[model samples]
Target: MTTRPRTPSRTPSRRALLRAMAALPVAALVLGEAPGLLGTALAAAPPSGSATRYTIVPFLNSDDGTVNVYQSDDATDFRLVQSSAYTPPSNRIRDASVFKHTDGYYYLTYTTHTWQDVSTTIGFARSSDRVGWTFLYDYTVPIANLSRAWAPEWFVDSDGSVNVIVSCSTTNDEWIFTPYVLKAANSALTAWSSPVALSGIGANHIDTFIVRIGSTYHAFTKNETAKYIEYATASSLTGPYTITRTGDWAGWGSYREGPALVQLDNGGWRIFFDGYGDGNYYYSDSYDTFATWSAPTALPGISGTARHFTVVKETVTGGVSITKNATRSLRSVNYTTRYWEEQSALLNLPVVTSSSATADKQAATFTVVAGLADANGYSFRDAAGNYLRHYNYRGRFDANDGTSTFAKDATFVARTGTASGAVRFESYNYPGYYLRHYNYQLRLERSDGTDLFRQDSSFVPATAWA
Candidate 1:
């Protein structure tokens, strides 16, 4: 195994780290004014606000048969990085996906099979810097004990709620458990909402991925006999999804599983699903939906059966990164953490904004608008540089009035911090958290504990208002 040199570690104040995590940029796609079942929360927007520049994050098996990360910036040229070990449950990770949430964490969900029975569970890990990562939560209970929830895909809504779409064939009359989306809160396996069905569409569904475009929630699932891709759209994530037998495949058993929705650079959509077989990879492209693809092309020699794949363009120190990783590890852990703040300069900082009547509110009414871009303890920062806050998803912050919910949006107090230019928010979670701008400067502990990467341009916030 090829190991990269350990990075230096210099512990920064808790406040500094919190600010870093909370500072990741948010660019809301202003869709048409419509709120129905298709009314998607802000979480479903395409990655990096671009609909072009289609890329793929491929999962590779090591020479020693461990799991590592290999990325293709252009879907054609692939390279590998010595990442964490892939301790499998059995032969290998059959199918998987690298799910990026609006809350700034990426989830790796996959299916693993052993000798006796087929089993699968969603492994939840986090990357504070979106590069180096700390494995956080792996489900104790298999998501569904049926024939196995294969290739689970994750989705986050505007309400800070998360859902997963998994494929399975159950014993309860329904032969195929039918690929459906299940809601999971934070990483709690028990906290998952009940399954929502997707059957009325097809029988052989596997590796389902859903993306919100405009007002429709589009689902991309793989069919066996047809060896073709199918799509469905609904207003809600947990939906009565309307089926569209829209597209077909190229190679035999070519388009197998793991259908990921990626936005292109020229402002369009590209479906990056896996092509199952030896020596060759399967992929299909379309600048316009409801139209025929240019045919399922081959991205050959990328990996040995690269099934589950995800793609995202993240702002990294070296340059922008398109990271891809997966899971089927034998051992894992799940933990719960919480963070609270004393409302410091970071939380109550002011931005330069002129006042308008629409911005004004009634007196003494604290309108706790929960969805601030950098509002969580994950984004906590203290001017004193002493305190640190770990903003895990379970953490929550509340204003007065008996209402509290954990999420990434900011809270607007109608009376106190609600006044324009009155609140400046900052917080940090573990890791080099996201910042809107590339110029964020701060003190951060490196891997070696003694050395640190401080005040780097990569940490800077690009948008001042953010």
Candidate 2:
């Protein structure tokens, strides 16, 4: 059995490292757009919701022949989330990638192999929630002469088609590794199309990540021989991509691999790759069209040894107020349901139903305004911009146009709903009382306190003001 080196000696000087990188025939292809065109193309757009970045790192346990799953909220800090032993036809799992689909499913793909044994099979699994995963099938590349498969990364197109790019060796005798593309037959990924080589003959490529920025598709891959992250761009997903850029930013001598790219919230891009020589992850950022990058910086807070991994953003939407409270009630345009008053001797409160509005309590029209407290929180405003406030002490809610001050009472936290594009609101001050639908009417009441509130409390996106 051939044992892979756990760590390589990091004794090379900075001067020697730079000299090694400079010796390579690095090419730079600059496809510059007009300043106005670039601005319009790369303009930052608000995400559907508050996005959370999630990363999956694999910890290969040779002793137990198991791979432990470590996850991170921020890319730096990681914690063990799951661990499973290797089963038959597979010895261990490594170089895992996690991809979240629009259908609310996360698919995990990893390289399956015995100890030092090369194989063409890649393990696959799917999870509704990120926690519990169900093993699907061993996705064997249809290449008849393939020797080994490594690092598999999945990309879902805008049209919902699923494609996976994997690095594999052609034969068992040679270490030449190249990337191959495979398209999933269906969203479930039960079957796949025949594998096609991404790179030309004699060109070594590994750890590939495909990212679409504006109208162009960019593929970032590690040149195994040169040990640097190189990039290629094409107008289409599956294409004859042009080699645009190539260089080792870390200048760590040819020990870096597994390049991953993520678009930051600031409309910039960050590239993360493993510094295998130093046994650490390093990152660099680009703000100006990926032309140049900041110096590679070492990431902190990572505990265990993580090999190839991938990061994805979790889409979360915020909440918005539909209507206000006053002499006028809030009515749904699609339904006869109107926010009406439940007149009682003890307490008169607002409820949404098919009941007709009275003269004393007419339907109230509200402007769904942005939140004053936070971007995720929303304020229910009257036409005049008066917010609806919830009294935390007494649980009394009212739409008061009198006060100019925007407090917690006027703000509600928006959480994504179970249904697609739906959102639920929770009182910012009184977290217990969620703005939910009760008795088929809109009411501020304590949630069943389940994992999520009912569908009635959920509201889909209506028209937004210009």
Candidate 3:
């Protein structure tokens, strides 16, 4: 060890799950970890009059060579949207983290080369839609004798500035990694200010993810020597940080790295990490911020597959070209003045001659997203991110139970309406059942092959009320 007073190095053991453990998911479950761990789930019903918000996880697959996109209404259960959604023309897509920029673009920052390469650069790609990506550029760290630059994660500051926290080392064979900060010099995010070394997160650490709550900055980083993630705090973004929790702190054990945290709408936080030594992915929850955590649980379907990826909780509206990004109101074909509405969680046809009142408008609007069971079909999501699903064949607005049954119950295949310029929805699971309203109440009933059923089932997508 040098008395250089600085320089962070490698967690030799953590390399076990680095690119070595990277990989793949769409199934969601409550945030449960190792049995007996406390799990926090969404409220049975979310507060009404909200917009559609989703948690998106973009990750690097171990055997594959691309970034995969998975989405969730709740942070616990994830639904796979795209496999190999985006790939840079060259270089390995490791430690890929995604963030939506202020300019209406989804941006990705990742380690450009595989672990074997001595690299000074982190790569970036941009997409107007999360599905299609165009390579932006590779940013070279200005460090002399830069041995490795890895896990460039976006930390958009409270002040709206964009910065990437990347760990760097001077020795290639010996990855002496410490987290460094690079501020975006341009709105394009292609250019950056010179890297600033993070104080106290000294050598032998990697994959540092930081989040700001109120005024304090909490840093969760891998302590290479201990092979466990440690928590640190500082007043400034660049810190002479204080390591508050070390061994067994937060109950997240040794041989863990790639820490990423996402805040839940329920006022809780979930931290995800790679248990590389065991080739598993795990997550823990903290209701009182990072002070306490639930036991680490294997991410259902995703635990063994995904490595070192970040999950972003974002609220989107009326901007992106993806039809799902925009919320729409379904107008009944038979009742021209009426639209679909949710009243006390029940789906009903309500008369709304105009989009004049906010209450009336929100009840009639739904966010349309790819079907949870079959992406080819469509699912209708309510303001609180719940789905317009059928329960016992009765139309009801319910939260995604993170079950295939719920996905199927919620999904509907669109068919040409009996009337021109309208559409009828055929239930995805019960093929014969269509979303036809009876007694002004929405329900999944089999078409009686009557004109009444056709008109009742058919609806036209109109402007969003909210």
Candidate 4:
């Protein structure tokens, strides 16, 4: 029983859907295929630039219970690639795990229900050719001494060691599956190590996915209560890891699971996840501290069952990558205590001028002009001074703006009331967030003590930075 979101009555094809979303101000290549149609499709091919194609599995046939694959040169268009239904000697197939190994082969693992039809086990298979696969192991590992297993994510360590993280629980208690990690090698399931518990993480974490960003390993897990994703960092592939960033969890949202993360060839991370009710997957770039994300919109297609999505660098002919200029401005501010980050450099208030009014009625307005930056949202705060009302960001504070910022570089208008005092813009950048404004300070400071380019207030009506 896979849970899929409901689709809109008048859903468009992938090409039409991408074309509709292309109207937003999100950062990406904007191209025109026809009137009211826009996408990332490029006629000319290059070794590296944009995602020339998209591949999906388990296409038309939902039965045979096989994992289908599809390919699209454009984000809006897709075609079938391959499908594999590895039953692994088990009676049923449920959750599946797929990854591209360093050895240049694709590896897949799925949860298999035991003969009793109550217990679940883990199975492994590999494919050099995407179509046909060879079964590697079968029903050798019972899911962490439990009868249930789901959502397996494969991680390859620096030394060619493969690690598996999964959601598991007692077969009878289907709603209580906990997340766990296991160690293994390319050899077989008999050589796999026992499950290791992760510190500072909880059983509530579900639909988990792990990725290697630079030298650090990060984990993104869905917090059902918060209704969003949370992030954790670990020094080693498997161990006592700590949750560093918890995204918008308690807000009015749903699903937000099935994280498909792919590092673009042009040095950006594209994360695809399902929106709870929209029956469509959403892609977000320029993530802030894993706690904050730009507003998520439906992906190009309406077919919503993406238990997990995978990305592979095409080495064959017709593969091309494009250099995407990230126009997202993430303004961040660091206070003595707590931290703040902006969804985009552009926010409701981009400029703030000192006023005689007190914190209760200090009338300050800033404009975030669209088309200047690929800003999806904005946040502001008085980091240096304490006022009666300070901005709170997801239980953390010292930031404000609106719940969301403008998607494009459009000018947004905002006024600060008496409760809120001096305002600053949130800076969004890779890995870290920096404060763009302090009370009466116009310069922005990087989290690592480096200084970003700053503009003098004398030339501008209000102190601001972009």
Instruction: List TM-scores for all candidates, in order.
Output: 0.50, 0.56, 0.61, 0.52
lDDT, candidate 1, 134-230, per-residue tens:
5444553343456555566655554545666777655342224367767775544336766666645555666677766656677777664344567
The prediction achieving the highest lDDT against the true structure is 3
lDDT of candidate 4 vs native? 0.42
RMSD of 2: 14.9
Candidates' RMSD to native: 20.4, 14.9, 15.0, 18.2
Highest TM-score model number? 3
Flag regions of model 1 displaced more than 4 Å.
Answer: 1-65, 83-92, 101-104, 114-116, 129-145, 158-160, 172-177, 187-190, 246-255, 277-279, 300-305, 315-466
- Model 3 lDDT per residue over 362-394, tens place: 888889887676664678888888888877667
Q: Is candidate 2 or candidate 4 better by lDDT?
A: 2
Candidate 3: 10-residue stretch with minimal lDDT? 1-10
Position 56, candidate 3: lDDT: 46
Candidate 2 Cα errors over 4 Å, as ranges = 1-51, 61-74, 79-89, 199-202, 249-253, 317-466
Model 2 scores what on Cα lDDT? 0.54
lDDT per residue as tens, model 4, 1-466: 1111121242232223323443545310112121111112222222332224444442121332456665543232344555453444544444455655545566677656522244456667777766666777754544534755666666655444567777766644444557777776434434677776555567756667776544566777776555567778876565466886665542315546666564432224556665534556666654343544444545543355443454443423422211122222222232211112222221122332233223312223223222122222232232232111112211112222332232111211111111222222222221112223444333323222122212211111222222
